[model samples]
Target: MPPRSAPTARQRRLGAELRKLRDSVGLSSTEAALRLKITQSRLSAIEGGRYGVSAERVRAFARLYDCRDAALVDALAGMTAPRRRNWWEEYRELLPAGLLDLAELEHHARTIRTAQVTHLPGLLQTVDYARTIFRQTIPELPPPMVEYRTSHRIKRQQVFWAHPPKPYSATIHEAALRMRFGGRQITREQLAHIVTMSERDHVTVRVIPFEAGSFPGAGQTVLYAEGTVPQLDTVQLDTEHGSEQLHSNAQLDKYRTFLDRFEAIALTPSASRGFINQILKAL
Candidate 1:
């Protein structure tokens, strides 16, 4: 099993609110459970943030505790609803915890902005492109493992088509456009695909030209996401060993600054599309 940690910020907040409610009503867990028509153990788990509470149950508990704070009750209800398991969970055995956490954050984000310097971002990669990249990794992954990882990446792309699809903005380096993933013919097809995808209303794709030289973001890739709640915005940095998630206010601020700087050095959407077409023709 993965090592356990303290509850997350959201979980802690929920637990504190529940504890306050119980105190206000002067009710013990057993008494509260009896009033709410649930077992004492269940109430204990909910208050401790070990188990998710149901919206209806949250309402019942709030009423029982004489919680007249309508806004707080609504917030609690939203927090307790069943969330879909992250798609990356299927790859739990193969991926590190940080990457899995980033995937979960991506699934829940309302907006995403990214910059890629050396390769196509996973969301934009074609199946052949993904396969080529995976097969080239050193230490030689087994064929089945490589296939599983590629399939997992494709599934991650489905988030773009989900109900109320999240908006995405990306700035890709020109070198990535020129790199031949699975050879020239496949690279041409991938470039053409990029042009088509960029035209979608929810996606913005820009190219940072080679001439945009030595910029603040010339070497690294970064992904920034805005969560459903304002406090959840996070930045993910991919490294050789693993990925890292940055959620501290200071780190998020720095990434936001980096994004603004990178955007300034990239081609406009229309120009980027024309640039991609030019590369496709040359290929």
Candidate 2:
């Protein structure tokens, strides 16, 4: 098969893990390719996520690299399964690849944790609230584009409702809940929706009140997706330019610590709901 021109984040991550395995063993790409009886280009294509890899091949690579972590190897092998068409595919052309990648990441995550100060987590955002936020895009988005984004975001929320849904924990700052993006009515509805969603058995919503000032990761919005194994976990940051996916050990470690701190400073779920109710009542 021809090499993929644009590999999805999951695909890239699988390849990256394979590369890390080889690097840890101190083997150059050429040497590894020789051991695997493949051409240098073939190895590079696999490492670059341009070519498909079989689960069997992944296991073989793991053994060749002398990796002892069975859980990580199993996680890597599981990622090699054949791809299926997903809801995000329809927006392949209309929306940014990063958006689609995020949907896929959430779909596969064992658990999802997010922290936001300026905006609510995408998965928890309402249609009107999201559309209103989109309207503020610097260059401005067309009406149709805004609708597309809003619908896509709503669709992404399916993960929360799926059978045996993944556990979701969101830590939101009081500032985000107070921001009235679309006006009082919309903001009121959005906050109410959050309270309702937080009532679900599997959903957890915590709030960092104004009293909890100067917290770590106060300015950035982060989504930390826990994969089947910790080694496959990822941290996504919303940046001015676009979504940035980070999986390096150091990056993941830093974000893990940041998330822990956020949770530590956040109000309990019940208290958070009451806090939001207070904000809603004030509005």
Candidate 3:
């Protein structure tokens, strides 16, 4: 088997910061590379998130860019530094790049808020529910692939319940509640699971009712994760082609607004729990 690819979230973040700094300084990669005494190709690699740059090199680049804040430079240096291997590494070969990226982001996130229109959020999905969803994919994935995907998803859910658990809030649409992924029994279990999860101090689940009608989401799901440091939140969206990360202030604001609007239309926690119980009893 081939060696697994490295998780690109950290590298991608470093690349983004480098580009931002360069742009802020009005220097192209070639200009920056000339000043840093490195070849344009190497600088391009760093800015493109394909290569890892050393902390010293990062500081030097910050200095060359005339970035005045020592703390900001130090934070970038820390972010660019190598991270210890995480258990998710073991499943790299079995999971999609997008899923792996999401898991890594979750591992580092101080808080995660998600809005889903058609399905339960992965962090809140039961094993059986995940398996059913995977098996229903259009291309008809092989049984082994389905099993692997399901297991990978379940493993990702561990972050929500890990020691010193991270905060998670999911706003799900009422449409998702009506769609039975596995069967009546599995749907019942899934709803019960949601009730149990909502009991956690750090977990909040809200439901957007069908009657709410035409909210900001408009058939999209988004995840906004707060990083270890402020100003490092990441917004992720799922598309038909793949996943896209949004980091710019405008993009992040757009999603944040969307989430806020969705929340406005969503049932409050107490009402959501009541709806969930109703579903469970009906099932």
Candidate 4:
């Protein structure tokens, strides 16, 4: 296949890992290419994610690198396999690349865990909640753009709302539920939606009330997307700018611990539902 002008974030991540393995063995690009019996430019392209690598080739690279972890190798090889076009692809041109990348990550996650402070988790927001948030975008988005963002966000939720949904856990703050994004009615509806979703078989929604006191990463949001195996786990964070994806062992470890701490201070699923219900009643 011809080289893609812009490879997806996941694809670049796969290539980056391969390059790290080669570096760990103290091999120069030329030497690694020579060992793999591929041209130097070909090696560069593969490492840059401009070219696709096969599962067989990934295994061969692991062997040459003397990587002893079978599980890690298997996970890496899985990344090399071709994937089907997901629903996110349809909005490739309409939305930001980060949004598409997020959707793709969630599509393959074995389990999903997230926490949001001021805003509800994108994967859990209702149509009105999502539209209200997008409608307030900086510089004021055009009507078409707002609808595009709303549409893409709703589609992302399909992973949980679809048949045989993936295991999901969302830790939200009381302030987020009471923010009144579209007004009292909308916020009440959003909270009610969260209550409904929490009752789903594969979903768990926990809330951190103001009474819980302070917590780590005070205002930041976190989305931990577990891969088929531990080695492929990812942590996606929402920032003042666009979203950021973290794949390193250290970053994932830190965020996982952070989330664990956050959840510890949060209300239990049952109590959280009651808290939301009370808030909805007042609204």
Top lDDT model: 2
Kindly list the per-residue Cα lDDT of model 3 for residues 1-283, writing each as its tens digit. 1211353776778878878888998998888889888889878778877777888989898888888877678778888757567777777777678877888888878789999989899888899999998887867889998998888888888777778998899999988988998889999999899999998998999998888878785678899988755557799887877677878878877888888888888999989999889888888
lDDT pick, better of 2 and 4: 2
lDDT per residue, candidate 4, 1-283, as tens digits?
7776889888888888888899999999999999889999988999899999899999999999888889889988988878578888888888889999999899878899998899999988989899999988887899999999999999888898656789999999888887889888888778888889899989999999998889888688899999977878899988768889998989989988999999999999999999999998998
Model 1 steric clash total: 0
Question: Tens-digit lDDT track for model 2 on 1-283?
Answer: 6788989999999999999999999999999999999999999999989998999999999999999999999999999988888999999999999999999999999999999998998998888999999999978999999999999999999998888988999999999998999999999999999999999999999999999878896589999999999989999988989988999999999999999999999999999999999999999
Candidate ranking (TM-score, best to worst): 2, 4, 3, 1
- Mark the regions of model 1 whose C-alpha exceeds 4 Å error after superposition: 1-80, 83-86
User: What RMSD, rounded to one decimal, does every model reach?
Assistant: 6.2, 0.8, 2.8, 1.3
lDDT of 4: 0.89
Comparison by TM-score, 3 against 4, better one: 4
Q: Model 1 — TM-score against the truth?
A: 0.74
List, in order, the clash count of every candidate structure.
Answer: 0, 0, 0, 0
Candidate 2, backbone clash total:
0
Clashing pairs in 4: none
Q: What is the TM-score of each candidate against the true structure?
A: 0.74, 0.98, 0.92, 0.96
Query: Where is model 3 more than 4 Å wrong at Cα?
Result: 1-7, 69-72
